[model samples]
Target: MMKTPRSFDHIDTWVFDLDNTLYPHHVNLWQQVDARIGAFVSNWLKVSPADARKIQKDYYLRYGTTMRGMMTEHGVRADDYLAYVHEIDHSPLEPNPAMGAAITGLRGRKLILTNGSTDHAGKVLERLGLTSHFEAVFDIIAAELEPKPAPQTYQKFLKRHDVDPASAAMFEDLARNLVVPHQIGMTTVLVVPDGSQEVVREDWELEGRDASHVDCVTDDLTGFLQGLGAKS
Candidate 1:
């Protein structure tokens, strides 16, 4: 049932981004963390909530991640920031055995490359019942705080896994993050938010669906993977 054997025949590594990429955006789990992020910035800078949001977005745009921006420009402690932002309730997430089955079908070494901490990745994967699907996790801490879209971060990940770019695929929710991977010869897939997403997203984040670097785009990751030889 493979949709296109030639497209994935050489792949031996499957890299996934945690958070919005692995799960549907409608889960609302990340909205809680996002709100916490704004609050943390407001408290840290003694700025109004509105101003804090601006600062947060600005940093995210400029540095690929708000945490990296905070560290580079404001000397924020990584551990404290990560812990504070991720303290919200985990009740929003629900396990998806179907998705796990699809992931289980991929014929390669699976991995998670995330800008967030590994602890957060563990919690999300556990909730999704996908903890065993991935073999290794390359988190922000492993990147030395450099976020993705940074060529060097991707380089380190590729080197660590001994991944041949031509034989690997990376799935990410953020379109911009795939730029470097595309340039380096990896097949890049963009996981878009489904229609069920009631959560608001920035206009800029939604603007890159037509970007040349993205090899595939899909709102239903399960179907996409299934088409690529996953089980129903």
Candidate 2:
């Protein structure tokens, strides 16, 4: 059954998650990063590929992100880890003029709240041809290395951006990341893959599909934004 889409007429701030939210997950952009992470774990811990895979997934489950788990357990350097993991080809993402146009037509400020570094976000936005659409990019470094699904990080992002949660709408690929946003009075939109099964990288990612916290669910971000702009 199609749930009635929540109204976002009061929304003045548009927040988005970078990686899969900005670009489609089907592009397999995260696959490169995932492989790099596994390699990092294998080399750093001097473990077998199979063992590293276990640790990688375990960390993702225990902590919001593998990086956070590594930092807490192994005292890993964030800068080095982020640099290595994000060192991948951005050529897979073609310039999305429709997405860019849709975003540009939205009212008020548009911002990116990503667990990735500023450098990584810049590379993606450049490839997507959306470099000029966003007003700011709040990366992990700005959040003191804390990732999404953390209330503290969301608080910091809201404070730093001076965003009123009541008048804001956040678009994200992960359903868990929308929880805090929804709890804090922001309209939450979950951007799931179109006509595909949910890609479960972690346990938390698989939860929240019932749309209890989500105000809206959309497979087509560009189309959603276009409709939103037209209504506005």
Candidate 3:
């Protein structure tokens, strides 16, 4: 419940991370991607599921993303990895009219900034019934496969999109990912898991609870947006 940035009124471009940031973490849609990554690693390395799981997480820690580590260490193709990992049933996600209306009511441009591929972002937005709200999606592939928390990728995204960081507000589920954005002067909001749901995941997923560079922490995105007051 830390005070959100008072400069929120200055935001002209809203940047949001896809995945758990957009959807309720309780839905566990990421479980499918996590499992697929483990399976891909297991099959590619000819290792047991337990060993593959370890390697997958190890890479995720070492590199910003498992795919990045795999590419650097194992010469894995980016296309292959992204395609393989994103193959999941997105049906678990339910559309939120409240969220859609809230986002629609917000002033200025809305963009999706995600480590996931454009296709994955599109599908998630579609499932959430928010496809039309976003002006553009800056995906991992668009960032030259470099993931968030990487300064270069953020720089590139800003330059490519003509976004002024100071006038932007970013929403992300991962706290670490918000560090660079905050450092670069964007208002950072951390989307926490719903208190009512059970969450089982990695250590990094839980790391941002400390709220280092986080300006705001909210489990209710729709309500948060609704409470932001009417657009100017």
Candidate 4:
């Protein structure tokens, strides 16, 4: 059995990952982004779809994010990569009233902590009608081009916000991205994607431990927040 941390007694700041964690992955927004990324890799590298997929997966495995791998291996600029990859149609992401209520329900200062660019984060939050939900959106650009899963980036965030690590709760969709925050003493909640049968991914297990640091793992964000005593 995984050891659960003590109930988050000290938390007063809630940091959320904007993409898959804020909205259900079934919304398929990321599916569109993935297709775009695959196409970009195929066209840019002059590779077939299979090869592009392989490269993308391999890079994501080696580096915490594909952009990091791209920069290290192909001299890709961070700004250009973010601009190209996040250019998705926002029409599909209609404002989710339930999500908005859940955000309003949660206590304390809310912030978006994502590996995405701030402009992309703004667009997403705007589309989801969540622009007012957060006090700030800390994007990858804020980290001096470093992405999540990097200890320095999280450290930098804490310093920038003047946040006490022990008083923050980080809710993230990707398990790999939660490792550093967990290590740094934040209450970590894994927003398990809806409809996923597997409790833990093999890659995340190999990259870190087997979800032991996670305080709670749930698919229903609204319900989970309610369970935590959030009031709408």
Candidate 5:
């Protein structure tokens, strides 16, 4: 593993996305939540399952989150939407001891910044054996139902925790989500799959993977975190 850049040494707070960023994409844990999202949309809109997926993706693209779009256009209750979509089986996810060790090794206030609910983040963290590492979970409710890539949501997060963006690092699986963090002067790391995972993502979400805003990219997040401890 390559030594992590010295720029990350100043980061006193570590912020991470919870979904694929925490666990491997191959685990298919999110696929269940995704299906439930579609199911919620279907039930709410009285549309077929096939049609619901289309609407879900469209809303996700139009707004930062489908929940936000649903609330705006359909008067859908935010809490209800979050509760319904997150009722998935998390048994498929396996714990990553290496990643858990790496996270425990990092010297900083670790935080979970997710578009999902705190309940969902909590469950996934427990599944991955990482529930104790993070100090806080900032979920959709905390964001006022506005997800990441929205500058205001990030501002809210930083303000809520008294975090300085320059002294923080943000890790995420989607390149688009890193744009706001990068622009706000935080070190941005894009965590990707190792080509072995069968992950699903929208075309736009993959667009800026190599863009200037992305300071680093790694398929192995645990290795990347471990590399940060290596001698320069």
Candidate 6:
């Protein structure tokens, strides 16, 4: 477990990553998206499902996102790709009362930072009954198609929201993506997925010394905030 930084008192705005961070990964929303991508790849490339999966993984690894790879290599349009991938029904997502309460508990302007389109983010928020918790949803479209891990994207987001980096917190499921915000002095929290046995890797630690900015790492959102003395 990592220790919480004493400088965390400066964090005031809380930016959350939608999708897997808002809900547990076990809900299988990404599994549905993965299947859709595989099918699209199989049909478009005329390959077997297994072969298509391998190709998709190859693209995802080569480009930060498979859509980026497709656009670069095959000239796939970004809008169409994002629409197809996010078309999965989100009715299966049940709201976590605990998460709802936790979001309400965190004192600050709450915003959603996502690579997904705003429409997709709205659907997910509605599904999780968390639409009211966020002051606004910042999507890939709003960021001019730049995604997370891109320093410019983070800069644009903070500027648009008038968020002070020294007074903000970003909670995300992806450890690598958290690096940019952590570097900019935002309190970073890594939400470990349930049932995952792998130890949480510290991006800053992996780079060298402990990240002077990262604040906490935990699987339980509510418990973590409660420990932080956040009040509803």
Clashes of 4: 0
lDDT string for model 3 (39-145, tens) is: 99999999999999999999998788999999998999999999999999999998988899999888889999999999998899999999999999999988998
Residue 120 CA displacement from its true place in model 1, Å: 0.3
For TM-score, candidate 2 versus 6, the one ahead is: 2
Clashes of each: 0, 0, 0, 0, 0, 1
Q: On residues 1-232, what C-alpha lDDT tens digit does candidate 6 reach at each position?
A: 6655634566679899886788776676877877888888787789999998888888766565677677788888888889888889897798777777777777778899988888889888888888888899998887877678778889999999999988888888777778889888787887766665443322431331244445566777767766664533
User: lDDT (CA) for every model shown?
Assistant: 0.87, 0.89, 0.89, 0.79, 0.87, 0.77
Please list all clashing residue pairs in model 5, or write none if there are none: none
Q: What lDDT is reached at residue 191 by model 2? A: 89
TM-score of each: 0.94, 0.94, 0.96, 0.89, 0.94, 0.85
TM-score of 5: 0.94
Cα-lDDT of candidate 2: 0.89
Model 5 residue 210 CA deviation (Å) reads 0.9
Backbone clash pairs for candidate 6 read 12-167
Clashes of 3: 0
Q: How well is each residue in 9-75 modelled by candidate 2, as lDDT tens digits?
A: 9889999999888888777798899999999999999999999999998998768889999999999
User: What lDDT, from 0 to 1, does candidate 6 have?
Assistant: 0.77
- Candidate 5 C-alpha lDDT tens digits along 94-185: 88889988887788889989999889988898988889899999988899888887999999999999999999999998898998998888
Shift in Å, residue 211, candidate 1 = 0.9
